[model samples]
Target: MQRNFEHRKVALGTCGRAYNTPCIHEHSCLRCSLLRPDPQQRGRLTEVRDHLLARIDEAHREGWLGEVDGLRISLAGAEHKLAQLGELTTRTATVHLGLPHFSHLVGRTVR
Candidate 1:
């Protein structure tokens, strides 16, 4: 899904739900349950995760305690999406199986 924030457009990945529906998260896609992160967008999501981590650190040092909590929540969501991508990769990974042997069947007569 695309989001327009701060005069810039950001692609937050694809939405798994129905199309043409309004977002209830106020353009905060990371923490929303409806967000089905795209595997191709891993880099962007990683950037967001890193940014959130830095923001949390800055918030702590700058005494922005309230912001840190929200940042942490977003961080968790980012990590979760990353994990989902990882799992998808694992599930779709190639596996090799040996070719079938027909030696025993070679001597058998057809029914």
Candidate 2:
């Protein structure tokens, strides 16, 4: 069966109604079978990344090597997604803001 799903309320951090897969894991979206993240989720993604970092730190401090390893993997994924989305938003935003593509050219002497 081909299952297709688009995330709905990311703020709630649950599978969207469109989700049809049976896979579920902690921070469901992290390991969801139908994980399809949208650019609009940048903010939430950042929050997730920060939380994962904290968890990784805590695990290491408590000598939980196994847990720390898992959290690091998830954290790397979140950071990767954030970078992808950040680049996309920056490109589109530059056009919308009527700014130069070369950031170094911004806010300089215009004589």
Candidate 3:
């Protein structure tokens, strides 16, 4: 039915790589290709993790993070903190690298 087809489509989109279509032939389909993680993204995530861990360590050394429960909460929040830091780092890097800000570039007429 239509509902089944729609569900299949959504599942395919979520599960597969954007440009990679499932093989139609049996032989090709048998040899399934694995999607590779983006190296830059992996590197960025590792960098973020290390930086956050170091900050947490520094905070603990300075008595900023108190008790085991507080440490657990801080560890749990590290991913969210890293995501926020990543966004800010990306924005700052983009600006520092001389790329015009999206807002500044928008609606400007070129002479």
- Whose TM-score is greatest here? 1
List ranges where model 3 is wrong by over 4 Å. 1-39, 66-111
Candidate 2 TM-score over all chains jointly: 0.54
Per-candidate Cα lDDT values, in order, are: 0.80, 0.67, 0.44
Residue range 1-111, candidate 1, lDDT tens digits: 244331232376766545555668777878877777778899999999999999999999999999999899989999998998888888956778889888987878877
Per-residue lDDT of 42 in model 3: 43
Write down the TM-score of every candidate: 0.69, 0.54, 0.28
Each prediction's RMSD over C-alphas, in Å, is 8.2, 11.7, 16.8
**Model 3 over residues 1-111: C-alpha lDDT tens digits?**
655433223211211333445544322211223222232344554564566567777777877756544444544443454454456556644334575558968899999
User: Candidate 3: deviation at residue 21, Å?
Assistant: 31
Residue 91's lDDT within candidate 2 is 74
Q: Which is superior by lDDT, 1 or 3?
A: 1
Relative to the true structure, candidate 1 reaches a TM of 0.69
